[model samples]
Target: MKSRSASKITLTSYDDLLGGVATLEDVREVAIDELHSFTDHPFKVKDDEEMKELVESVKAQGILTALLVRPLKKGGYEIISGHRRKHAAELAGLKQVPVIVREMDKDSAVQAMVDSNLQRENILPSEKAFAYRMKMEAVKHQGVSGANSAKKVGKENKDSARQVYRYIRLTYLMNTLLKAVDENIIKLQIGVELSYLSIIEQEMVEEVHDSTGKYPSLEQAKQLRKHREEKSLTKEVIRLLIIGEPKKKTSITFKQDDIKKYFPPDYDEQKMRSIICQLLEEWSNQNH
Candidate 1:
């Protein structure tokens, strides 16, 4: 008896394999090199654990979803979404990944890009700052009737429009300060207040921090801004304001070795104390 022959199965696109009808026109696999990131892409494509997991997923199971892209006038495609997926695919050693092409104007593309990435967790403050700014501009360019473009953008993001405007204000901060905001070294509320300062004033604040080893409290930041508006924000003023008045002593202690190192080998405790008092007096006079 002859054995029954097995049926041959031909595999095509993932969409086809799942018994879903392909729209054919929109989705296709394109060379990775042919795709470019959206202009002024606000989101970071980090090589962190999340990206590592994404690469592993693509390597093992393949990209389950297609990227959204739009064709450029000259040639190639610009990624409106899936920037992270595209980076993961590259790391996965795929020569091409699937994408869905859409025709969109600049404003439409900006809105879409922001909307898509905002859903992700772990978004940095810097990313949200620039993204909110871009979206606000795009909303304005679309000729939304009111002056409240931020409000319109907020509606799309499910956030309060005032909150959106506050985020956008962070874009004015210098990169170093902005990074501190991202790291939470500078809290968001204080960062917003600091953002109102001019670049020169902000640099002065940075200088004060470097010299004194202190970051301004929220109250200090507010005072700094007030002085700035008064047009009396000098470096000396910044230093005085940041350091503020001396507070009551909490505790004071000195390491014996540290004190000994600063004095002669035969110096007694009294001698060491005398030298310390002299040095501190000089320091106090110079600071005053």
Candidate 2:
């Protein structure tokens, strides 16, 4: 998908131009001296070979796309998106890459960066957690601010504001699992469930996780969680089984006719059958 540009918005100072236009010449390559990885927007460069190929391609084509950046009050610009592009530019021996400058408060900057990354087909679970957390915090700030106003934002925006509350809750996770999540070693929704486990519990969960290699469904994780809570299983014990499939609580279903046909004519027994009452009657009786 084509990235949307905020180039139309012009500003007088570099800070005000945080979300505005930036040209290649206007962007500087200050010796890679003071630049740091974006704290809020973290992602790993997946393929070194691919990145090298990208650098070669970029050198040949001259950075076909520009990176999105926000102004830092101290110095240089915060890269909101196109991290790979920046790395490729460095490898390509480019002095300065094209960029779109924009004014984004901390929260807005994080959300913009995350939103852009989420659009990608694949992103690390750790990356998702941080990005999701950033967006949620931004929405939360917006909600708190809107609450004080007489003309407050409507319910939809308010709901939108709360949409990521649970996702953001994942940020409280310990570094090990957080790294696992970021590495795409664990599923996002599963990571959310794992997040509910306390720090100690999460460590145990991680043990099972590491032993399992690949996580089972969330249902299995929930069962492991329950088993730990109820039976007080040792972490090692849970690790032994947690990676495997969960047990089926109910038997598989088969058509009654199919079962009956397989049996002899006189094999009917009351013990073999169970019944359910009609829901319509139950509803009518409840109303009456």
Candidate 3:
């Protein structure tokens, strides 16, 4: 094949596309104060040890990569990525940082924000929950089907489509229950089952976990959903599912066969009983 002649790139052509403003790929120094967090940004910018390291790096070398931002009608730029880096720059006492300006609508911005942050290694369940939910809605707004949206969101983060939908279910949970999922007190599957309950019902479940140190097993959570569907999941029903029915003047009864081996031969029955009570109280406090 014959070699094709190369065409020269013109700066004027780029300026025309941007309506006589700076080009899309232009890296400009924006004052740190002028950059704002993206609206309803799902990802967190934490000040943990990793953030401290980022701050130190910024202090020494400045920002190696430019942040992605778009101009807002309100005068400041909205950060689409590099929230942690921007925070680090603030902490590192930098007055300005480099940024690349792009024009994006809200839906596109949400998708971009989610895609960039999902690449992090140490994200919480709640973060993934909200981020996936946001990105899925954004995709659907752009006219994608629910299944395809889930697939696209999942592929971006190496999660299965089913897993993406599962994560989004967690968005239904109340704050306390969601925090429990983040803390691993409630497993993901159980959280999904519990998520079907109404907010008031979830508040009851949170109460059960708070007053008594009991969380739902997977089967128990499924049963809770069954009761929820029947519209009979009251606080009393929740309590019963969590800790089981109370005995008449419930006692910490121990079967002699099961209890004898745990205590020393020299210990009296009263002493063993007291020690067991003390241990149970400690466990309760820890869970509380």
Clashing residue pairs in candidate 3 (N, C-alpha, C atoms within 3 angstroms): none
Colliding residue pairs in candidate 1: none
TM-score of each: 0.77, 0.58, 0.77
Sort order, lDDT high to low: 3, 1, 2
Tens digit of per-residue lDDT, candidate 1, span 102-182: 788888888878987887888898999899999888888888745489788888788898889789889999988999999
lDDT per residue as tens, model 3, 29-110: 7899999999888888888999999999888877766677889998999998789989999999988887768898988888
**Counted clashes in each candidate structure:** 0, 10, 0
Q: What's the lDDT for residue 225 in model 3?
A: 100
Please give the CA lDDT of all the candidate structures.
Answer: 0.83, 0.60, 0.84
- For candidate 1, the lDDT comes to 0.83
Among these predicted structures, which one has the highest lDDT? 3
